[model samples]
Target: MTAEVCEIVITAPDAEWAADFTRTLVETRLAACGHQTPIRSIYRWDGAVHDNAETRIALHTQLIHADEILRLTNQSHPYKVPCFLVQPILSASPDYGTWIIDCTTRPEAI
Candidate 1:
């Protein structure tokens, strides 16, 4: 069976924070992997427009893990309002999809 998966997009103020945040998700089995890239962001907040340099991380993982990922981001992200986007992966190579499922599932806590 093709396991359900998704790509989660998150932005950090810098590469250091992006690396640390991505590592935390992978270490906790919340994501199978994260791809980071430098980006420039322009957006409006608090009735003002702002532009900034940021690091973007695209995380691959099982769909089931999205909620927990959001929870963690809410608790630890540096921005008062962080960017978190979960996009569905409609198709993936069978092996890769299975790998994501395997990497993200963990034994339930006692």
Candidate 2:
């Protein structure tokens, strides 16, 4: 692995779903923290263009555990084709970056 940390971006149908999933991810150490926002999404699906309101989540986690995070998201996310985008954290404050790595190293059941 090139780095020890990564950010996983995902979209949820609503705030409730994003919040619930964020809680689970944090508790299970799949993610150290999550940022959620309400967003307007316009996309083409099944040969039709659609516009909808959605929740976007940015999850911070250790690179080593990214696959497990995807596993959990795939299992619980409501979307038939959930978007799970993984981006390497190229730069961050040393202390902040360390904290993220530390927080996600320890796991707990919720």
Candidate 3:
């Protein structure tokens, strides 16, 4: 089967949650790499506009594992309404793409 790459972005309330979430994802092989960046988000919540600085984790994984990744994120996420966004990878370096596939693939002798 051909491998498909994807990027999943999830926002956390703080740095700690971002760190914990990234660790869990990597340990479970749901993601190959996760990058956390601080972001200032302004959005409407409950008819009121709110602005806050948040940490966003960008998870690099295969499309085949997206459902499981989303499920686990929602299950363990701290936010009442977490942001889970999936973006397809249009292009990437050949080596990095191969690495993502290798890291996210199911183990053969498992």
Candidate 4:
């Protein structure tokens, strides 16, 4: 049976933050690919409604790496609470799915 691929989405304060975090994840083989973009966010914080600019990072990886991704992001992100959301990619082309698995596969321990 094929394993599921996940697209882990995170929102950050700016483009630099998104890109840097993405780089760390990819370098460690925690994610296969990452895309980033600027986004406007509207939400309540500290009991006040606020609108702000944010950067969104979408990372493609196998489902098995989700926890490590979240743990690393939580440790590295500047926000009191970073936006880390995971969505299962249920219909990827067979080749793309295999690619995700291949890139994100955990390295064997010595």
What value does the lDDT take at residue 90 in candidate 3? 88
**Cand. 2 TM to true fold:** 0.92
Candidate 1 on 12-92: residue-level lDDT in tens? 999998999999999989999999999999999899999999999999998888899999999999999999999999888
Question: lDDT for every model?
Answer: 0.91, 0.88, 0.88, 0.87
Better of 3 and 4 by lDDT: 3
Residues 27-97 of candidate 4: C-alpha lDDT, one tens digit per residue? 88889889998899999999999899999999999787899888888898999998999998868888888
Output the lDDT of residue 101, model 2.
81
User: How much RMSD separates candidate 3 from the native structure?
Assistant: 1.9
Candidate 3 per-residue lDDT over residues 1-110, each given as its tens digit? 12499999999889998998899888878899999999999999999999999999999999988899889888989887899999999889899999998887778624
Over 4 Å off in model 3, which ranges? 1-3, 108-110
Say what the RMSD of model 2 is: 2.8
Model 1, residue pairs in steric clash: none
- Evaluate candidate 1 by giving its C-alpha RMSD to the native, one decimal: 1.9
